[model samples]
Target: MTVSLDELMAALTRELKPEQFKDYCPNGLQVQGRAHIGRLVTGVTACQALIDAAIEQKADAILVHHGYFWRGEDAVLTGIKRRRIKTLMEHDVSLIAYHLPLDAHPELGNNVQLAKILGLNPGSALSRQNNHDMGLVAQLPAPMSGADFAALLAARLQREPLHIAGSEAPIRTVAWCTGAAQGYIEQAVAAGADAYISGEISEPTVHSAREHGIHYFAAGHHATERYGVQALGQLLAQRFDLQHQFIDIDNPV
Candidate 1:
């Protein structure tokens, strides 16, 4: 079945609620394409490779977690940026993206998806200081060593996370936010998490985890985020009966 680009956007907007959160990029539709979309493609980022893949797949619209025109980025559309946009325009493929909104969606967001994959039951917002419910804290069913928890992440995420030692005790509580959210370890500490998991680890994160007495894990940014878009794609497929394909472009970082 086919749906109008605007209709698809409306469905996504109603589900994600982009206006609820302050995001770095535009949430709904980034590029205009043909009016009706029969084939929809989803991916983690709106990169050139994903665009090429979508075009090859004859996709009518592309939904993604990351899109262009990020806040504080270079305003000029030059080099690769120009090429990506030009290719989409030339092929008449719609580019729809959701950033912070996708991450925080209570049921379909990245955090919730990752928690489901890791078998971690989300309890509360990771940071109590703010109203933004981006990350989540989960008390484990049973306490396990930090090494064992890292191994579980490795098995589930298919990538060995960078583990930083902090507390000697087993990890009973973990707070996690997917995709370049290492800075939230402080919030995890404040939440009284025994360990914290995020996509990227900065230099200061090591010290923060150590000094705060919390274990830290740096799961791959791309690895941890692969599920949410796929889940969203499946939702679109089920809801609209549109042909949905999720293209995963491998990224080491």
Candidate 2:
């Protein structure tokens, strides 16, 4: 079965509800390509490597959490950006992206998927943007030391997180926001979480965590966000009977 590009876009719009949150980039169909998509590719970012791979796989459309045209970026396409867009156009592959919507989706979001991976039970939403929750507070099955929790994150994410311990006590409650959400640390502290996890850590995060007696973990931004797009891809495949693939391009940061 194949879905029209418009149909796919409408489905994504309905599922992600992109209009609810003010996003850094446009939420859906950043680039137009084939009208009927039978094969779809999803990735964390719409980088040149992922686009190349999708083209190699003969994908009809590419769906990603990160896409071009971020707000305030130079409107003119040049260098890497130009190359990426040109490649997609050459291949006749549609490009679709959902930034905040993908991150905060109730069931298929990056936060929910990461929690499922680490066995964390989600509690309440946090960090509201445009009246929509952008982050989540969660509970571990049982209390564990900050070090133990860090180890669990490393084991699951396959990357050692930078651990800044603010308390010596075991972590029972945790708060998390994926991909460069270290700014939400204050909200986590206010939520009375024992530990906080985010993709990137700013210089001020250390002081905030220590002052508030809450642990902080700098999980890799790329590492933490590799799930949502895949989940969305799988759903699309199952829904439309399209051939879907998720290609992960490595990024240390």
Best by TM-score: 2
Q: Could you tell me the TM-score of candidate 1?
A: 0.97
lDDT (Cα, tens digit) per residue for candidate 1, span 16-53: 88887767778889999999999999999999999999
Clashes in model 2: which pairs?
Answer: none
Question: Ten-residue segment with the worst summed lDDT in candidate 1?
Answer: 125-134
lDDT of candidate 1 vs native? Answer: 0.91
Q: List all candidate RMSDs to the true structure.
A: 1.3, 1.0
- Model 2, span 114-215: residue lDDT tens: 998988888899788777778899877889999899999999999999999999999989999999999999899888899999999889999988988999
Write down the TM-score for model 2.
0.97
- Per-model CA lDDT versus the true structure: 0.91, 0.91
Error of 1 at 201 (Å): 0.7
